[model samples]
Target: MLSAGPTPRVSLDTWEFVIAAENGTEHRWSWQELMALPQETPMVDIHCVTHWSKLGTTWQGVSLDTLLDGVDTGAHFALAHSYGGYTTNLPLDDLRGGRAWVAHTFDGAPLAPEHGGPARLLVPHLYFWKSAKWVRGIRLKTMDEPGFWETAGYHDYGDPWREQRYQGD
Candidate 1:
């Protein structure tokens, strides 16, 4: 396990995982399946919307890059399907550079719910909400669709370093 700093044992705070579809197809993932998916580990930092950055978070999960490797979506956009009907969209190219991952474990252990456990999308370059909690699946789309936060006036592509938090940019 290659890590940059002190790695803490991650934990999911004993809560059930919720997985639902935006198209009304409901499916809840079990703890077993969350643990069974193939894993690609990368040590990263998290930038929360509340204006704090947590560094050196070791995460292990199925990389969207790896999962979508051979599959030909031939589409430009995609939606991150999550629990509670929450979703965020992104361009397919943004998923490159190891920045996008479907993370299950953080710091050598299962991710805690407060930290977006069971499964969450880790788009490290964007705001934390984009790192959604309870991720079920991703819907690859040809047209761009905004998500919960985006509809609430947040930036469509939340680039934190530039303070892209609102819709102006």
Candidate 2:
């Protein structure tokens, strides 16, 4: 059985996509430093490889392009580091595409813990696992790598469009 927790709220700040998250299964970020990731455009649908398609969910966070702005991500790749050491890897090019975002709010409301609020990587193009929950920081690498799901049987490239969900990858 599961229980519901308090609802989350979107911060007025967060335009630059900057956020401060803590170690939590639900969406929980510190108050003093934490702020709802700012508003964004060009939102999209979410397709979970688990056979669930949560559509038209609005989110506000920094776009991959905006986050990587000014910072040199070298030429390797990127890794999303989450609480409890969960991680996911991606090609530098894909991360640079700007489709991905660090979501703090959902559907015009604050993100609930079950929804990966406070800070969750929102990569609508990839499978849900690629969007690591309880996300903390992003480490851009120099190679197309894999993370917890990728190492397990999930696809290395979790492209929802291509239906790439498993390790035959």
Q: What is the lDDT of every predicted structure here?
A: 0.69, 0.64
C-alpha lDDT of residue 69 in model 2: 59
What is the per-residue lDDT of model 1 for residues 40-126, given as tens digits with 9 covering 90 to 100?
888877787777899987888877666566555566776786555667877777776677887878888877755655678888888
Q: What TM-score fits each model?
A: 0.76, 0.74
Give the lDDT of residue 161 in candidate 2.
83
Name the lDDT of candidate 2.
Answer: 0.64
Clashing pairs in 2: 14-38, 26-113, 27-113, 76-141, 76-142, 76-143, 77-141, 77-142, 77-143
lDDT per residue as tens, model 2, 60-154: 77676765555643456667776556778776566667778777677777666666656678888777777766567776555566788778777
Task: Please state the error at residue 138 of candidate 1 in Å.
Answer: 1.0
Clashing pairs in 1: 12-112
Model 1, residue 87: C-alpha shift (Å): 0.9
**Deviation from native of the Cα of residue 110 in model 1, angstroms:** 1.1
